[model samples]
Target: MYLPPHFKIDELAAIHAAMQGSRLATLVTATTDGLIGTPLPLILDPREGDYGTLYGHVARPNPQWKLPPTGEAMAIFTGPDAYVTPSWYATKAEHGKVVPTWNYLAVHAYGAVEFFEDADRLLDVVTRLTDLHERSRAEAWQVSDAPADFIRAQLRGIVGLKMPITRLDAKKKMSQNRKAEDRAGVIAGLGASDDPVDREVAAMIPME
Candidate 1:
């Protein structure tokens, strides 16, 4: 990933926060056949390593796990994004030099990949994933809610994934390159837009 100094996210805490906040991630790996990408939810164990470890799973029928990865695997996490029209930039009114751009946050984690199918590990992974997503609910559901035999059968249909993240690349491109007036215009324009995501992007922009 390209890292311009102005947009780079180097702080470990910030990088971890971005990854955790973006629940769904794109898992990519290269193989003898070609590049494969799967979008799924991944949980981070920040205590696993100097960086952290990633946990997730793929369907048993998914070909991605069948082939051996030629190199390192990557997990891509993305945060709120919004479209910025030229009309939102003050420079457009000044000299018609501005163009449309996007404001967003992203983090890429790379490491060795391992696949497993052990029932116990799968059960643990499934239970933890369920808990993570359901924690916000007033009446959170648990793996125990389902019949034991049924849950075991369900776990058999998927393969577990473990990746000890060796490195991370994070970036927050939130109109930081724009002039103050242009950024203010962008904020006001996005904040007033009909899309809730646009308003989210507005809140992410740095004012200082």
Candidate 2:
């Protein structure tokens, strides 16, 4: 995360929000065999430890969980992102000096990774994760909706993981470096875009 002062997100609440809002995260680890990465959904427990803790599960056969991480593992979370055209910069018309860039939000969490196979812990993690995502649906689903034997059988095919976060790096590159006029132009251009995500990035930019 190469964070310039203007782009760094220092607030813990903001960082956690970005992490929680991300639907998927990439978990990366360095092992004797080299680097391995797994894409999964992770739940952040802000109440645990100093920074927080991450909980998720991986398929039992996934080699990522079997490998011993040499040091700390990292989970990468990314939020709304969009490409910014130089044409959106008001300064581009004045001096023709501006180049295209990107606007986005990202967070990197580092901690010692712990993989477990305990059925009870796996059940708890899966239940909480299910509830978090399902709560928004008009007809929510639950772990208990399935038969106990089926749920227990399903849990056997995966392993649970937890990482007590030791470090967090968050960045929000939302054109904070641009002049007010240039930023306003960007907002207008993005707001006119057909992509809803482009409009989302537009709204995140600060005028000041």
Candidate 3:
């Protein structure tokens, strides 16, 4: 994460919020075989460590969990993002020097990874993960809604992961480097875009 001072996210609350909002994340590790990555959903336990802890699972067939990481593993979480056209910058008309860029939020968490197969811990991780995502649905679902034997069998096919975060790097590249008027122009352009995600990114840009 190459974070310029203007775009760095220093607040822990903001960093955690961005991580929690991301539905999917990429977990990457370096092993003797080389680098391996998996995309998965993770739940954060903010109270678990100095930074936090992440919980998730991988399919039993996935080899990522079986490999021993060389050092720390990294999890990448991404938030709303939108492509910014130079045409949206007010300065483009003045000097024709502006270039296109992207506006987005991202967080990288590093920790010593732990893979576990204990049924009890796996059950707890899945239950909490399920509840986290299902809570917002009108008709929420629960692990208990399924038959006990079925749920137990399902858990057997996956391996649970725990990572107590040792480092966190967060960035919010939301047109903060642009001039005030240029940023306003970007906001106006993005707010009028057909993509709802563009509008979401527009709203995140600070007016100042």
Candidate 4:
């Protein structure tokens, strides 16, 4: 994460918000063979430790879990993102110096990963993850809804993951580097975009 001073997000609470707002995260680890990445959902327990601990799981047969990690693992959480066109910048008309760029928010967490197969821990992680994703549904489902035997059988196919985050790096590039007029133009352009993500990024841009 090459973070310029203007684009850096140094506040812990803001970083946590970006991390929590993201549902899917990319877990990357270095290995003797090469680098491996897995797309998965993680639950952050901020109270678990100094920085925080992440809880998730991978399929038992997934080679990522079985492969030994060479060093630290990085979990990447990406929030709202959109493409900013040069047409959206006031500078384009001033001197034709504007170009397209991406505006986005992201958080990276680094830590040592612990993989476990304990039934109790696996059940807890699965249950919590399920609840988090299902809470917005009209008919929220729970692990208890399934038969014990079936749930147990399913749990056998997965391994739990726990990473106590040692450090966090967060960045939000929302036209903060541009002039106020250019930023306002970007907001208007993005707010009128066809993509919902563009509108989301527009909403996140500071107006001042």
**TM-scores across all candidates?**
0.98, 0.99, 0.99, 0.98
Clashes of each: 0, 0, 0, 0
Stretch of 10 with least lDDT, candidate 1? 85-94
Estimate the Cα RMSD of every predicted model relative to the unseen true structure.
Answer: 0.8, 0.5, 0.6, 0.8
lDDT tens digits, residues 1-208, model 1?
8889999999999999999999799999999999999999999999999999999999999999999999999999999999999898889878998889889999999999999999999999999999999999999999999999999999989999999999999999999999998999999999999999899999999887
- The residue-level lDDT of candidate 2 at 69 comes to 97
Clashing pairs in 4: none
lDDT tens digits, residues 1-208, model 3? 8989999999998999999999999999999999999999999999998998999999999999989999999999999999999998888889999888999999999999999999999999999999999999999999999999999999999999999999999999999989899999999999999999999999999998
Between candidates 1 and 3, the TM-score winner = 3
Ranking by lDDT: 2, 3, 1, 4
Q: Estimate the lDDT of model 3.
A: 0.96
lDDT of each: 0.95, 0.97, 0.96, 0.94
lDDT of 2 by residue, 171-206 (tens): 999999999999999999999999999999999999
Residue lDDT tens for model 4, 1-208: 9999989998888898899999899999998989999999999998888888999999998899888999999999999899899998989999998789999999999999999999999999999999999999999999999999999999999999999999999999999999999999999999998999999999999877
Off by over 4 Å in 1: none
Top model by lDDT, which number? 2
